[model samples]
Target: MTREEFIAAIAPAAVKLRLEGSPLFPSVRIAQAILETGGVIPAWNNLVGYKVGSGVLTPYWKGRSVNKSTWEVYDGGETRVRADFRAYDSVEDSFRDQDLLFDLERYRRVREAKTPGEQIKALLAGGYATDPDYAKKLDQLTEQYALTRYDKEVDDMLEQLMEQIRLLQEEVRALREQKAMTEIPVWAQEAVQAAAAAGILDTTTGGSYDFYRFVTILHRLGLFDAKGQAG
Candidate 1:
């Protein structure tokens, strides 16, 4: 299928799932689809990044690889087992499995996102991909494909989540204040002393300060090393 056709077929379901679950999956799915199939659609309808094994003699046989190499199996199964991967009957199955795979616990954070953008951002922040610019690339894809057009219904969802986060932060701050008033633990005193000695914390509030800012101040005083590490 061509990119346009693939989007037409899968984008609706992706939008529906994103609205129901998380927004990030669609972009990741799109990127993976492109990577696995070399387009927004699969060449042989193999949507799940499946690899064929050496034993498969079928015409659709792409290539081969060992299925399970580790020896942790109790039955002492074949050390180099070969297996056939499922080639999907249609593009729909591929899209379906894409959603199903994201539902797995490994992607729980992205799956739980309230919006597609939030989900994509969370995946990047959570280290879903090693690429340092993964989030930016996903955002570019989202805008390029106009994926957010399908997200109009959930436009305010992110705002609501942000408000909820703010309230939780306030509650956490109140709890910490209560804890602080009740005790000045030895560890806390030691931390204060260390901060004062390192000049990285505010002595009055006993709040941990950013070391980079301290380093910048030190650098102005000619104390920073050439590499920006503490001198």
Candidate 2:
């Protein structure tokens, strides 16, 4: 996934964790998503790489799961094992699970930590991850992209931003409906006008203008004629 896509996907989860009063910094959690998922947004929606200790896919999980061969490392070294990782109905559910992990006794120090770095150190100390440099990697992803920006965006602000975006999309949709082929460049406009005059362009509409209709018009006028296939 692109950096922008990664940031957009995790922003809501980070903001929710912050608003819910989780002591873990948003950057800490956002970086965890990036590092754990290898920056790819999976269809399973397991945002934090949480694994199910039990191998079975019992109904108790309340979500789907996929078993994959995973690695485990400690001071003794590394070992590979197939494990069932937690699945979610959405990324937000997995994020909520991450917060629950920090509430365990092993991560008490993390809850008591003040700085982001200290919290990461506490997680490493609690053996939250198998990698020896887990803290350093989380820190690098946090600092390099300033993921903490999501921490400061509260729920109310997020709601307001989403509403504004929805309104803007509506406005753009309305504008497109009122537009005609005359709005195009002169060369393109003349071509479209000729097509319209020839009855190749479908002027009969149920008061709607969608991309599919536009493509159909182009095809009827012989403007889109590609015979190749795309994957």
Candidate 3:
């Protein structure tokens, strides 16, 4: 599949994986996948191009393993090494298995990193990949594909939801106050007219406002004394 098609195919699972609270940013993960898969997506079914060695590649292991020649960088140079890479039944397992990295200290550091760049650096330092330009390549791919768009959209949706909740709460408060203002004694009404005529209330509503508003206005004007009852 084409790059765009490949990304679209995996985007849902990738975003879901990110929501699982993995410290690796979704964008970084996507970029890494793009780099690793590199036109071999369906052939390998390994989304992260996972290497075998965490005890899953032993001869008696129950999972699938594929022998392949990979560029192994060691001692300042690279050599093509034929090794067994773990295979998965589906792309989703490959994606989910990425969490296994958490078992490593460096992977934990990558998650603990405070920024995208730092996280990539942690991955490289932790020997997650051998390429010296691993971080640069991942960073460039992340920006190039605008992979962070998914995370940003999720964040924006959450913010809008919170704002709507806040507005609803305010409306409920207003309605409750409107309901509680059921019994303003006639004496209080007369007091309000007297206060307005005396220009002691801070109102431009022409005395045709809510009863609670009048009470608050008078309270603010010190007409209620300290007991909250108009004196």
Candidate 4:
């Protein structure tokens, strides 16, 4: 696939993986996929050139693999070698399976990386690829394509979700306050009963706290006689 086609095919899964709390940044993930496959998407759906290293089969990868010719750098020299690469049914499955690798102890730094650059460094430190210039290549791809925009999109979405949650909390608090205002408090319950008994109050409910206090004070001053009239 061409660069644009490859990005279009993988960007959605990359963004979704990041938004779902994968520590890998969407920009870095997309750049990695581009760099790993050189913008030529493999038919097996292995977007990031994942290998069948001693990893156990999971729901995302069902122990299927393909043998392919790949390049590896060793001792400052590059050579084409045949290797076993894990295959997936879909691009999303490949992305998810790649994320699952981060759960390993060796990839802890990758998980803790907060920035795209930091993630690249962590990936390099963890021996994700044998290429000495892997970080630089990934960086170039990320900058050239403006892939970080996807990361920003995820951030904006999360902020909007948080704002919605805050609004819901405010609404809940307002309802609680309204309920408190309409309910009779223990301090004003006796006055409310007296008013109700004297037929001075149509109902002993739906009054604000201040209104209940005012009625209690008037009752205490004996303003209403037993006939429900002012004394």
TM-scores for every candidate against the unseen true structure: 0.41, 0.60, 0.65, 0.84
Q: Between which residue pairs do clashes occur in model 2?
A: none
Candidate rank order under lDDT: 4, 2, 3, 1
**Model 4 CA lDDT for position 134:** 90
* lDDT, candidate 3, 81-156, per-residue tens: 8877778777767766777666677677887877667888888888888899898899898888888886675567
- Top TM-score: which candidate number? 4
- Candidate 4: residue 174 lDDT (0-100): 90
- Write the residue-wise lDDT of candidate 4 on 1-231 in tens digits: 578888888888887878888888999999999988888777798988889998689889999999999999999999999999999999889989888888988999999988999999899889899998999999999999999998998999899999999999999989987987778889888777778777768653568777888989988999767766655
Candidate 3 segments whose C-alpha is farther than 4 A from its true place: 56-62, 160-231
> Tens digits of per-residue lDDT for model 2 on 183-207?
4433344434544565545434322
1-231: candidate 1 lDDT, tens digit per residue:
676676666666555555665434555555545544445553446654544423443433323332422221224432433444545555555455445555657777776776666787776565444455656776776777776665563456666778999999999998886665554454456444444556554555533334334434554565534443334
* lDDT score for candidate 3 against the true structure: 0.71
Off by over 4 Å in 4: 185-188, 195-231
- Candidate 4 has an lDDT of 0.87
The order by descending TM-score is: 4, 3, 2, 1
Worst 10 residues of 1 by lDDT: 65-74
Stretches > 4 Å off in candidate 2 = 54-63, 152-231
